[model samples]
Target: METNMTLYHGSNIDFEKISLDKAKDKRDFGRGFYTTTIREQAKEWAEILNYRSRRDGCFLYEFTFEKTDNLHIKSFNGITEEWLNFIVENRLKGGVQHSFDVVIGPVANDRTVNTIGLYLSGDYFLDEALRRLEYFKLNDQVSLHTEKALSYLKFIRKYTWTA
Candidate 1:
């Protein structure tokens, strides 16, 4: 189906209002994007609320959760810095598109008492493509296109954020 792809330049508040359930529904209809675990989904929602990127262009952030054993605040702080560095190095090689427009942090979260989070961001372009893909009538073609887009995004996120 033909689509008029529009850039998603809405406010973080608007993104925060995006229901996870609705996103899941879109995923279902689209049938390609993986559904993240509940914990990860919650954290994504949190990021949407707390997003603080400069308002100039489109960007994507990857949030990583790691379980830790130490409870010392100092140790956790140190780890957070290391994690940020790791994400930064990885993002550099991720081949993110210029259209991505922003590269933000991997806002950490405490998943459990011992767990920590590391979030990373860069550019993203597939969101608009996915939105357009939603109009395609052929389910198989839609699935293929969505999967390809997801794979490309994942590759960029993974390689860009890792050393």
Candidate 2:
């Protein structure tokens, strides 16, 4: 990993100056600075945020994280039983938190949400869920889970949302 890697976060709020103190609970990765390496995914997220939460245009904020040597990071290769279980635990716990500074993995976006529900709700087996989820190539999810992780971030720029 590079010492400085660019990460993009798309949101309805202005992150020019951010405060994670107000981050909501029960998030997919549990109230962290969620970002993606893929720009188009962020673009889609910006539109979604604009449509669902804000009247104003969605803002795309760029940040650089010193990923190589600065923090304790956990990387999940792809969607698997281990990844699914961890995500489910964090989401269901809602208030429960993790000690990891950062977590990098596939984002359980809208497409996977239903499938995740089925697996979690006992509607599908692990193999069955993996078979279904494999149809869609998952996008990356980068979660800055702790304040220490935030300290390593440098805000880059803000972009206007375009549908």
Best by TM-score: 2
Backbone collisions counted per model: 10, 0
lDDT of 2 at 139: 93
Single out the weakest 10-residue window by summed lDDT for candidate 2. 14-23
Write down the RMSD of all candidates, one decimal each. Answer: 20.6, 1.8
Model 1 per-residue lDDT tens digits across residues 1-163: 2222111111222222222233222221221222222333433433454445433322232322221221111111122344334333433443221221122222222331112111222232334323332343321111111222332232112101110
TM-score of every prediction relative to native: 0.19, 0.91
Reference-based lDDT, residue 63, model 2? 84
lDDT, candidate 2, 1-163, per-residue tens: 6677789988877655666776778777777778898888887888897888756778888888788656778788988887888888888898436777888888887889899899989999999988888788789988887778888889888888544
Candidate with top lDDT is 2
Instruction: Give the clashing pairs for model 2.
Output: none
